[model samples]
Target: MFGPEGPSLRELAVQALSSVEHGYDLLAPKFDRTPFRTPGAVLDAVAGALAPAGPFGDGLDLCCGTGAGTELLTGLCHRSVTGVDFSAGMLEVARRRVRPAGGPGVAWVRGDARALPFTAAFDLVVSFGAFGHFLPGELPGLFRQVRSVLRPGGRFAFPVFAPPRPARAAFWTLLGFDAAMRVRNALWRPPFVMYYRTFRLGEVLGGLRDAGFGVELYPLPEFGWRADGSPRARLVAARRLTPRPAA
Candidate 1:
């Protein structure tokens, strides 16, 4: 659901019909007004959890979008923070929104996540609401790229919410949404790959492990739990393994 300031149905239609980059460019100015932006609550929860693990030197926000996660990184990282994305339009909005102010140094880069430009240059990496843009097959390369940018013992972290149960209304809604997206991609060009159901936990954990990350899940207690006592949300912290030399 969008607020009054959010994009109209006609506007959304225009975006959906365009390429991902162009679509986001059109949506950039009002991205925060939509449900698409990472919520402040989730950002605060991640920042709180990261405090103990960090006081990190520098942080990178992969696929940073309008830099909501980068804003959070400014608090956890000590030296600097960089927000990277392929969309020039999104980066432009991010640059304007995240002015170099409270704390850590800030920089914006336009690049693809599949081929990150740095090697072991960051101590922390975070992402939000951008996973849906990547297909399941792209996870390995994407994770590898993130790992390549992080220092030894550095972390790549992100929050994930529990999937809606089949009995729930939200379940049907998401299922229908993903189904529609699949149909759209099958029928369209330059396929937009956003799908909520595609990023399963098991597959993601395996992908992270394959990409040389020692992964762990931390429950976010602020959101409480489901009736079955499972956490409503969790933070996935994946540490890049120290490389071993060949014999």
Candidate 2:
């Protein structure tokens, strides 16, 4: 579902064969042109939900990519917004795209998300579309790093879509994609670790609790509900608890 400006089939094949970071570096310039970028509609809905939860001070966008989620921070946060990503190429594009045009201040930092450098430095943090890059075993460290960057009672938020049912074509498509990815990684180096079906809500909630967050979910009304009456999408708000002193 890529546009004329998006990566060609040959280009995508090359990227799929490379390491995750290197593939993204090559894709950074045209990322927004592809369906892979988080849609503006989702961003707007998230911003609306977060507005009542906020008036947040400083914000961080974990794995910000080209800064789509960073744009949401501009409206919710008052002081400053920082977009941190491991890819220098992505950060370079984020820097250029998020330049201050009388908006909330923006900064782009290059670093690994699993080892965030800030400690209690942010009032809020958010991510989008980047979870697939992290394996299930990495969730603990990843959530811990996000928690480490937040002020006491600060939130780490992101939107999650409900999983497709087995009867649906979408479900089969995702299952096949994940299975192929597993086969590819098994045969490749620096493994491109994206799997659409792996980040289940139950598992993620458990991980958030383990990482010291009091977790809650808020429905995103924009996408409506499924036939079973459950919300089709939700915002996962994980508030960091105050750290306990060593006994």
Candidate 3:
């Protein structure tokens, strides 16, 4: 329902009723046309933010939907780039659209993020617009999975926008959407499992810490600041800790 090129209302209804993986499988062809795709502006800002920290060896785009974040990795990583997701349909679309002309070789892997199929293989990892699918309690295990796939001192990065205030319509809109999803899941089989408000910043940071990451937040100046002077958006860069030499 995002545009002429986007999914129709009926299509969206069908998707909403399906399991998460199957829903995206149904939507994958037109997913980029939907507002659900990460915006180019945000991707550009994240690329700019990550440039100095990279020229990385190999990279992974965790939960790499239609490959927006995977495309971002092409310029930053030197060796090779891989996109992993649970949806075969999404991976098919990504394979067609995310070809890099002269940069690192790109590969698409179909696998769940919670059970990634790689070891300490990536020098960098990035994810965008996929966390809402994860429940709050899943963060610790999720972060640990991300950490497990990163080499010593490797970084897992993603951008987070400031949550809208209660006075704002956006806040209520997200709240209502999450509430509706809860009700839908309660009544439906094979729950869709997406919630807008579950990934609180404090909880995320704590989970990253518990996963043994040394975290840093960098303000994304492209989005400006809130009235309270905090950044409107921030990049969360969580680095995997290298093991100390044996005593």
Best by lDDT: 3
For every candidate in turn, the CA RMSD to the true structure comes to 1.2, 1.4, 0.9
List per-prediction Cα lDDT, in the order shown: 0.92, 0.92, 0.94
Off by over 4 Å in 1: 245-247
Task: Work out candidate 3's RMSD over C-alphas.
Answer: 0.9
Q: Which of candidates 2 and 3 reaches a greater lDDT?
A: 3
On residues 35-114, what C-alpha lDDT tens digit does candidate 2 reach at each position? Answer: 89999999999999999987999999999999999978998888999999998888888888876567578888889998
Question: Predicted candidate 2: what Cα RMSD to the true structure?
Answer: 1.4
Candidate 3 local Cα displacement, residue 18, angstroms: 0.2
Least accurate stretch of 10 residues (summed lDDT) in model 1? Answer: 96-105
lDDT of 3 by residue, 157-236 (tens): 99999999999999999999999999999999889988888888998998998898999999999999999899999999
| TM-score on alpha carbons, each prediction | 0.97, 0.96, 0.98
Question: Against the true structure, whose TM-score is highest?
Answer: 3
